[model samples]
Target: MTVYPTRLTQLSLLALVVVSMVLSLTSAPTMAGQTYSYTLPQQAYSQSRARDYQVYVPDNLTTPAAMVMALHGCKQSNADVLADWGLTAAADQYGFVLVAPFISSYDGLRNENCWGFWFDHHRHQGRGEVEDLHQIGLAVEDAFAIDPERRYITGLSSGGAMAVVAATAHNEYWAAAAAASGLPYGEDAASVSLTGQCPGSASFHSVSQVASDMAAELDDDYPIPLMVLQNANDCTVLQTAANNIRDGHLQVFGSDGSSQGNSEASSTACSPYYQDRHQCQHTRYTENGQAGQRSLVETIFLDGPLATPNLQDTDHGHYWIGGEHGNNGKWSVRVGPSYPDIVWDFFDRHPKNGSTSGFPVITLIGNNPMTVNLGEPFTDPGATAEDSEDGQLSVTADCSDVDTTTVGDYFCTYSATDSADNNTTRERTVTVVDPNTPIETCEQATASPDTHIATGRAYAGGTSNLRAYASGDNIDIGGSFDTWSQVTLHEGVPGSWYSSEPAACGDDSNPGDTVCTDWQDTNLNHSLAGRAYYAGGYFSYGGDDYLGAVAGLSSWVRETAPGHYQSGQCP
Candidate 1:
């Protein structure tokens, strides 16, 4: 037997029920993470403007883990990006620290939380957004033991452009970078907007031109591998911007725009990440570096049928592709390739050393096997060392065991050590012989010895001239050598022994003496001059005058006869 409740009591019960339901629906999900906030004071690097940023440290984070700076698109908040783009979950699963910076509304170039990547000040190191972001990275390092070799940055749209800026401007601080639906670095707003409307003329600058700009602005020559993602139907950022980014990065990496070829991607050979979504075209660019052919840039183009009839639909346009369904914010899609997984995978392959480890690459500059006369003072040919994070490092040689008095085989060890305690060492073999021992001719040394044939042209640098070898019926170096008069020397001479020292010429040269050497140039990036035999000396390509130029010993020879040069001491 139940008693009927009064109208007042029933109304109170209904109100309590409504309040309970509201609280249940609006309660935030329990997360095994903690969020910290900070406001960077006005500093020179930040253009004397205070900037705010947030960091999300997931539970069970291990020390020396990778830190990914996750940037949000226009009109988006850090919290919105972390949740909608599944960055929070990615942090928890991947065990990485995430940093997100907020654009101040009071800033002169602020556009609804868009980063100031379009302006010149924002594109360089220690200036505007690039500096603000770098400060945030430094702040994170203070709180965590982030792997200096594993620091990476990625973003979408405007954030994508800013990521490019930060990664390139302070390139030494970052290991790798990824951008989705973003404009090329240093692109003006007018150009970007115009390209967005007219896809045909989307690329404002040539790929090589853009690459030159990027190379000029880099803090170090160590190329930062970049991953570019684009949607085929994206009308906002358009496919043209992605093309610019992909091609420009490839050019900077010295790649020829050739794909690494993944059969599972783009083709029907394998299903897309989402069966119902569009397929992705995966093209990877590789260059022959000191480490061999290595992947430097990868472009992921999402292609398939559109979700709507309108081409300008923002809902189906530029976004962080493959975000969680029903939980994404504006510019985040639930279909196509998974950006988080793809970007992280790419970043994991490339570290500060250009590999998974911190070890630097040590390259011997001169010849590997060298010959010296007994009782003659042996001057060791130096080597060049480079690390991805540390840039160029000082190389030290250990020639203590060498005894010029005795004739035997010895080793000269060259080593390079970085601040991270990572080290690399290389060896050069030195052979000492009796002073009376006759030097072996090229025919006696090898079955087939190529001729020391090369051409030279008088450069118009007033005092400077150009002399390079012609190999295999073509000018060894790519480019036009036309209109330049060819001066031949060292012809008919077998290329057996090459000198590592410059020829004594001009006031010091005595007549009727010939000195020549075949020199091999070792550049880690493989972008400059190549292996060639030159007379009248070889300049060290490792300098400011050329890309990836390192300071080293130059080789020179004097002309004694027509088309004939010999390797001997200068008189």
Candidate 2:
């Protein structure tokens, strides 16, 4: 018997693996299923040092069965995971395939025969062991007719933490996740050893922060549910870690840890019936009171009479509880309310609803609609791209079209492509405006006897009174004012303006009535026919489209400002 390192310190792990090799020579437990070795294909996108894995196909297993990836703890083999964790029996009973992958070789810093969950390279998808494990799962899925929605992952101790990392980093890959006696997502063995707490040190992000970071590019609409098993008497991992896991997942699912419309399930409820059943307290959390919303988080803490030691830390309560009776080994305890049974039940209820391409999403770092003044230098704020498979990708920005010297609307385009060739593009509008351009104003002289500036509101598509002076009678101007046009009066020639024809300028018979002169469309100025004149040059009220116009008699006009003009004044 070897004293396995239950914790994930590099030094302890290195020493433990040297002796654990002896146990592999011993005969494995006789399971109802057949177990075989699988060498995972090396992925060019990953830096994984571990590849060898094992699979257990239950007797009489059929197509469309569920698949579970079981990661083993430190100083443990894949065989130990299947036989010790009672997954072999569970697979036989539930008719699901069991995939047990372990660290076959010792990476310099990562623990030998243990998961690299605490290592930065392996914590995310498509990088290190995370990618290796994902490839292994895919390989198994291809080999067997596994249901995509029924995929799941579970682990113990260091493996437990890896399970969380995998499920979060690749949310679309797994339907559910369970961790037994595991550390939080970002916690390190050193910090956990010192404080016996989660979110171990400030050097690493908190559990909630890790969860949020993992979900930054994930779809929030379909969050993966999580189940955590904590041994209350376990001093190796500490029970506080379970709280961190529960709280972190609650944040991921946008739950406040309380039932919105459904009655809250008590955390103190424990199952007392099963053989050798420890006082197992269960707590469950749901996203909301929605009719079909299932529990997003669940926690089970086991505490009772201490069982005989299977290996080191069994007395510490850090081993897997409720395995096969009378056939216990390293980290395996024959206690009640079986861990495998509980995990399988939780996983069965939650399945993925839709498919995801694992595509990268490009998110603009700054404002989507940005403003840049004319003649000022314009700098693109840039963007960020993240993928479910590829962690972070380089974003290319094409802002060459955004010229600040010109007063017009422009766009800055950004795009990113992942290693898998999944690409995404995003655009931000850049508007350039000339600040020096003069704003047209309507100044009404209150006491001027020659002119009166009357300000009125003009509606769109109204009958036009101001005419361009056609062949004989006063004809309406062909161009109408834009919508919500403002009617402003300014002091100008009392006659109406006509298009280039001098004959159309005046009504010779009633000479004092309608006076007209040359007013071109190129210039902003125009003249009115009624008592008031369109004195102010054309100006935009908000943008370059709106212009000052004369109010038609039929148009709805409330006098914003009023002034009197002598009726017969002509210039």
Candidate 3:
């Protein structure tokens, strides 16, 4: 028997159908290569579920690729984070899968949810957030054909802080991690903000405190290598905070259980403590002598049983990633071939022990031949060593051809060893030539200021006196001759010339004259007697003092001969 429905029941059924339709219309669709957010089950506090992130899979995905998780800062969206960090270009070039997660709010503050690196002090904050992030990374790895062992994490600013937390907390999972402009857990304001009131609390761990905790949790002997980038001039986060974090980690990892002392002076504009610790190799990239150049400082603590290495730098700011920063404050999309090149290099040296696979094959430029002339020094052109496992390998030259005596074509072989110990050898021939060339000598000659002039030219028809001056190169002629004499032109003429005789007179014998043979003046020749000459004057012998006074008046001038100087000439 068919029964007619009551009016109230029919209306209820119609309302249920309308409600189902509305729910279906409002629900978001699961699209390809898109991230979706879900609300987590309600706990003590209203917390959100982990976000599900996906990216478009290339048509060719035969080989297993690496995966990287990029986390966003508080109040930042996935799109903005992607735009700022921009790792897609690197992903495309290196065939690595990339994922980025967004945080929407904190304590119901609209658009205020940041990574919990700083706010973890609250019971329901940092741990849950970190777990969610871990789940998301595993989900992405499972969804894509990614190599779990090759998983990596890196971030900037707060995101950078998160990366540090993840690396320290989950060191077993990440092969390598890099943090820029961010400190370990206990180093940031989060630590102070959470534990400021409880100053006496002994069990409390600051953000930086977490690094020591995490290091303790990991195999202390070989903890994962961490790369930190910081800026010395960063106005936002003082460089001291970063150094403190570095020092704290060093203290935790060092054998002495104490941090190195500050070695830099205040006048140098660097923290003395930083210089001292860096010398111990406890930090990386701490000394930035050049502008924009990255400093890498490292220290090894806990030998053998448990060793943890620490690296630090002071040339990066919040949002400043490793490498060069763009003018617009965005990481460049173009990853130079060298970018992936270096990443692989760091990775090869640090291997995931779980896998026995060899490092990637690398072909390097080999060394070339060089030539040097005899007596000429020559430096090797240098050979390049490459390994198929590691990219652009480093080469050490045996320099067999480098000898003190060998002059013929010599062969020097260069050997390159990869991180895996795979080695390759290359030989280069260098031709040493012997040439004959004369070694020239350079000498300079000097002249003294000395002159002997005949008075016959001036005293032609009558007795006249002649005065002469002399000069030469490097000559010193301040004093006159020892003896002086003059001979009369006519023979047997007593007193024919009157007055004092010339102080610098010729010898009494008249050595160079035939006329008036041996005729001589009794006094020394005073060549310049105060502008007076003994012409037709009587000869008279005078004391040495009289001759010296007349000789003092006669001045000598110096002159340089043309083309008499040389420069840069060996004597």
Candidate 4:
């Protein structure tokens, strides 16, 4: 047995020693992805003691990256946050870090776990939990290469409630924040009564109350932009609660500007005023749909004093993860470019300390000719400038020299200036042309259907009166066609016709009268069919009903005579 206690025994001894050493070494526990979970120091709270959070850091850390803290809802764990949100993939793709903290419960029951803070109560109640979150944020900054300026907080349901609380309470720490299916403020006693025993009422606070408290903390000169997302159909948080929070902000900021119009009926608009007297856009989203269905409301707030409102249709029931709801209140997650992209875009646009430099481009309507006259007043184009920082826009035009006499091209330039002094100029062109010309008097114009005589067509022979109608451009002349002008005709050679004009023929002096001479030879042959004929002279018919080659008498030569005379003689 002196031969080193059998090979198997020696290996077993070695394994035991190794296990003991590992237990003593304080190594982190490994999880699903080989990620390590560690615990921080515990803190005390009103109902329970706070525990350190578990965070997952990607291995691809090279440079500093944005940090996103995803808090868990009531009765949900760090692991639940991870699994439900499935944000690891997004973190990997977007090159950001993720941290999830646990809100330990008094009861050992894991399902009782929740974020310690409440929306409708005093912040002091959740001191331990808030401290833990603050520490966790600081710890993340220390543990990972985090861009302090780009830190963000987002969550779902209860978690979302906490995220809003954290972001609004600690605005200095977070660049931007988003909450899904979360109330803007905590539940009050009345709200609790309405919704039944609100489980997270310990630290609930009204959004208006919170805003009032936070007013002092906010930069009076420039406040941070806050974006809120809520399900119109969220039965738990109730969309009205969120509206109260937004209204509080409006009251503090002073609603001195117009709200941007939106089509979503459930949405309300508000604006925030900065110290610079500029208006920032703020909007509230709410549930809007028939009962028993899903709907969504979203709102964005800018940094200015004035608010602009925009809205869109969204899904209901706490859909921050974005997908169909699974069995256990879990949402089936699907990653998209929009969520992370919007997060980054909003973060990029709004900086911590009133810096609008390097913001994204926003285009606004410039002054253009909505209407223009043919030649009268000269119109000039106007434009205004837009900037990522100072959106103040004003447009001016130089229309003093617009030429009305010339029928040619005219150009007007407009200059725009924003609050930051950024300028943009645009020009619009207008053209003037002469009014459409009227057809010459008595000219032949075709008539459709040939049922009634049209203006500008000639009439030859018979009792068919040749009428002349004239239409004026840019002027109005009143009278019926029968009163304007008339023409008459008479027989010349057998079957031939002669026409006469009122003034030209000495017989029919009345302006509306008609006379006939050799109309077919004079007017019909000279112009096309349907052309108006200006009879030059008058003529007469046979005696009684027919004056033979008689002078001074005029009659219209009817192709069909009244008596049916085949030859030239009255019965």
TM-score of each: 0.53, 0.53, 0.42, 0.43
lDDT of 4: 0.40
lDDT of 2 at 544: 19
* Global lDDT scores for all candidate models: 0.57, 0.58, 0.38, 0.40
Compute the lDDT of residue 15 as modeled in candidate 2.
22
Residue 203 accuracy (lDDT) in model 1: 39
Question: Candidate 3, residue 531: CA error in Å?
Answer: 99
> Could you give the candidate ranking by lDDT, starting with the highest?
2, 1, 4, 3
Which pairs of residues have clashing backbones in candidate 2?
495-515
Better of 2 and 4 by TM-score: 2
lDDT of 3 by residue, 270-360 (tens): 1111101121112332222221112121221110101111001111222332111111112211111122223433343343443324433
Highest lDDT: give the candidate number.
Answer: 2
Per-candidate RMSD, Å? 28.3, 32.2, 33.9, 31.8
Model 2 Cα lDDT, one tens digit per residue, 320-380: 7644321244666655556776787667656676333445655554344567889999987
lDDT by residue (1-571, candidate 1, tens digit) is 1122222222232222211110000012334677766666555443546666677777889888889998888866665565556566557756788777777543565557788777787788766777767776876776677989889999888899888888778878899898988777778775344333423244366666777788888758777888888878776677878888877776665545433332112211111232233656656565643232335777778774434311112444567754332132345644455566567656766877756556766655444446678999999767766565665689999988778788998999998998899988877778788967534332211111122221111111101113222221112211223233333322112222222111321233565444444323233322233222322333222121222234243333222222222232235
Off by over 4 Å in 3: 1-48, 52-59, 108-113, 121-126, 188-222, 250-317, 321-351, 354-357, 360-392, 395-571
